[model samples]
Target: MTTGMEELAARMRDFAQAREWEQFHTPKNLAMALAGEVGELIGEFQWLTPAESSSLDEETFDRVRSELADVTAYLVRLADLLGVDLIEATKAKLEENERRYDANLYRGSARKAPH
Candidate 1:
């Protein structure tokens, strides 16, 4: 069975409600929180080389995973407050990205396709 965005969103809602943090979860505030979480996630990789990044030890990996979950939670909360369907929006955005970045043309290339 797959756990979907709805369940995650519900949990986030309840968690925030329980803490009486709804007022602090405005889209702008959530976005900033999300950014901070992302920054924390990035900091985990700050001095790691590519190989080191790919080979994080268990303890560090767990920290990275938790930071990632925090980012997702804030992002979901922001989307929920803004009346956006995260699942549908993600699917649409993925489709758009696929169209904009053709694998045939972009294969083995790190450079983004010019608009």
Candidate 2:
């Protein structure tokens, strides 16, 4: 069965194909675009306190949602072109993190785990 990420990637592929935008969607270009979108998303929260950031007004929240979608679209497209299985990669990374940062050792600590 196709995963949701795969379906999203397929749709993203079709979108670029339809627009003949693949030429502009090279990995580097996509990575840069993703960074830009992340910057926009960050800007949406830059002035807010932590609590305010979590409780954005409706208009601000909508803009945040749009920026997030932009970031995800670029990420999905980039992963698709590189033949990366995002879900599997995420799972593997989570497993590695679990091993590296045991909850009993790292819980409530903001510092990075020692190498």
Candidate 3:
């Protein structure tokens, strides 16, 4: 069954609270942790060529998956701690992006539109 953000956030909160990790779960610390996890996720592709990166072996894929989960967890934790609803924030950002990157103008283009 699929779990909602509230459930996930609650789980993270319980996990942190149980370990008395709230002291370390400040926005600044959580953001830093998220960044570090993202770095680790990127490191999984560090030596691979573009094609190789796209087709990872099982072991490599597993490592990347774990790192990705870490990144997501930390990001959710940070958003929760800051009282931000990530789902709403993401939807709002996508709406903003639609205005900035109109499909008709930006379609199939690699260049970013100047704000």
Q: CA RMSD for every model?
A: 2.2, 1.8, 2.2
Each model's number of backbone clashes? 0, 0, 0
Tens digit per residue, CA lDDT, model 2, 18-106: 99998999999999999999999999999999999988999999999999999998999999999998889999999999898998989
> Candidate 1: which stretches are off by over 4 Å?
1-3, 113-115
lDDT of each: 0.90, 0.92, 0.90
Q: After superposition, how far is residue 61 of candidate 2 from its true place, in Å?
A: 0.9
Once model 3 is optimally superposed onto the true structure by TM-score, how far is the C-alpha of residue 100 displaced, in angstroms? 1.3
Question: Residue 49: error of model 1 in Å?
Answer: 0.6
Best by TM-score: 2
- Using Cα atoms with residue i matched to residue i, what is each candidate's TM-score against the true structure? 0.88, 0.93, 0.90
lDDT of 2: 0.92
Per-residue CA lDDT of candidate 3, range 1-115, in tens?
4458778889999999999999999999999999999999999999999999999999999999999889989988888888998989999999999898888988777666655
lDDT of 3 at 45: 96
* TM-score pick, better of 1 and 3: 3
lDDT of 1 at 100: 88
Residue lDDT tens for model 1, 23-64:
888888999999999999999999999999999999999999
